[model samples]
Target: MSLKTALRVIAWLLLAGLIFVTLSPIDLRPVSPAPVQLERAAALALIGFVFALAYPRHIWLVALVVLGSTVLLELLQLLSPSRHGRLIDVAVKLTGGGIGIAAGWLLWRWRPQR
Candidate 1:
């Protein structure tokens, strides 16, 4: 597949993961261990970073997409009887998304043009 196609596929997958991490009620409960959560957050951020790098021309769009998803999920949590939103959770998601975007920018900044 072409680079653009691959990037788009990755972008969609990242978004899907973001949705899963935030919206899915089944596994949304806080895990017993904090380390696992942090590790998962880090991975999510790394994925965001890679996608941001692949689509740097739309950085703000990417940020909005990432942040927007977080907000949307939080809203959903508020609506759900079993779930409520937490500031710390939002902060964690934002941190992960920001890290991913920054990491992608740094990694791709010096690469030669195609």
Candidate 2:
């Protein structure tokens, strides 16, 4: 498969996993007992990184997609008996996403220009 196709597949899979983890009632063991906000931020950062790699030419669009999905998922959490949405979490997610986008952009810029 082509590189673009592979990236797209990875991005989608990451997104699916993100959604499942975020909404699931079961608590998966985290690497550490970090605060929930940190966990959310870290997860989002990875999501943003994958998304940026998947659509490197449209960085702003990727940001919008990431932010939008974050908002949508947070809202959906209200329906989950085990979860509730929080504005702070959204803010942290955005911050983490920004970091991811910046990292991805730097990597993209350093790549050999064909």
Most lDDT-accurate candidate: 2
Error of 1 at 98 (Å): 0.3
lDDT of 1 by residue, 1-114 (tens): 987678778878867776675556746644555585486467568667867877888888878877677767777878766667887877877788788887777777767879
Write down the lDDT of every candidate, Cα atoms only: 0.73, 0.82
- Clash count, one per candidate: 1, 0
What is the C-alpha local distance difference test score of candidate 2? Answer: 0.82
- What TM-score does candidate 2 get on C-alpha atoms? 0.85
Compared with the true structure, model 1 gives a TM-score of: 0.78
Q: Candidate 1, after superposition: displacement of residue 79 in Å?
A: 1.4
